[model samples]
Target: MYKRILLPTDGSELSHACVTAGLEFAQQLQAEVVAVYVAGNYQYPLYVDILPPNGPTEEEYQAAMQTLAESYLQPVREAAAAAGLACQQVIQFNDSTAKEIVHTAQEYACDLIFMGSHGRSGLGQFILGSVTTKVLSLCLIPVLVHRIKHH
Candidate 1:
């Protein structure tokens, strides 16, 4: 019973799985889809007094980040088009991805969020933490987590 489905993707294979599942659910519910990519924030300090300057330039880093964020949306866009659903996309650069996702959902008036679960086992999950878990903790909308099993 979803009217607006928000799908956040990162261009990972797992995210693709999530998109596929989300598309099916959205189609079944006759819902519109919103694809979002949250660019990880840049928090490093600017160091202009380095000895030998051969590192990536500020403009280069920004361009690379933007490319990565946009690249993640390509497959999702194709999938939505093939499914014949009304689709929209947004790219956000945020320190907290979970927070951005929840905020976007509210901003877009989405009813449900379909996302992929990074199937990390006990120890790995404990060490790395999980964006999906964080999103679930803060989101007011329903979240469907698609766990892609790796063989």
Candidate 2:
């Protein structure tokens, strides 16, 4: 039984399925749901050369990121509200998605994390690996991965 469930969404269809599954688990356990969106930080060394000297100072860039965060997590928030579960949203800019997710779960004291398997494979898997796999390897809390079949 979980008291708090952490759900991460990336605005993808599979992420939506993960949110739905998380909601069902939260409903069954009478648990609160926390939705986290981890934004990619552009400060990495490889990207340093590509960024302007000041970096992302444009209002449009900031606004776009903000809008993205809100829109992406909005459905999850609504689902939790409809289910009568206490819900909160978090946005973090980080270089490592898996690290951020694991950290957020710990910070929120979540008993469980429900996520989607993005199902990357072949060259893509070799190049990018999987965030779910990395999180599963690093996390301490219980992880329930909803495998969303890729079309």
Candidate 3:
């Protein structure tokens, strides 16, 4: 009975699988979908003298990241359109992926969060950290994680 579903995608194959699953669920429930992409803010060292001369400025890097994020969100928009479901795309610029996802869901009043897990285990997860895991722990709304099996 979800009226609004929030789908966070990183443009990975696994995430696309989650998008398809989320769309199917939304279609079944006759709900709308909000797809979000979180772009991490580019951080540079405070010592400008150590930077490369050809490196992009902070504004340029941010713009490039936003463009890439829009490209990543395009497929979700098209899929939702083909399914004839109401869809909205949001591009959030923040360093914390999990926080942005949860914040967007709450800001939009989404009833459910449908996301994909990277399937990292043991030391990998511990060392790299998982955004899905963080979202699960922090989000107030129900989260449906789609785990893709890699053969």
Instruction: Estimate the Cα RMSD of every predicted model relative to the unseen true structure.
Output: 2.8, 3.7, 2.7
Clash pairs for candidate 2: none
Q: After superposition, how far is residue 81 of candidate 2 from its true place, in Å?
A: 0.8
Predicted structure 1, TM vs. truth: 0.84
lDDT by residue for model 3 (1-151), tens: 8999999988876678888999998999989999999988878867877987878889999899889888989998998999999999999989999999999999999999998766445564333238888999999899987766556
lDDT of 2 by residue, 1-151 (tens): 6899999988876578878988988999999999999987644445555766755654655567778999999989988899898999999778799999999999999988898765544554233238888999999888887765456
How does each model score on TM-score?
0.84, 0.82, 0.88
- For residues 1-151, write the lDDT of model 1, one tens digit per residue: 7899999987776577878899988989889999999887654556546623655565766778888877888777888899899899888878899999999999999999998776445554333237888999999889987766556
Q: What are the Cα lDDT values of the candidates?
A: 0.82, 0.83, 0.86
Best-performing candidate as measured by lDDT: 3
Collision count of model 2: 0
Question: Model 1, residue 130: displacement in angstroms?
Answer: 1.4
Which prediction has more favorable lDDT, 1 or 3? 3
Q: Measured by C-alpha RMSD in angstroms, how accurate is candidate 2?
A: 3.7
Candidates 2 and 3, the one with greater lDDT: 3
By TM-score, the better pick of 1 and 2 is: 1
Per-residue lDDT, model 2, residue 132, is 87
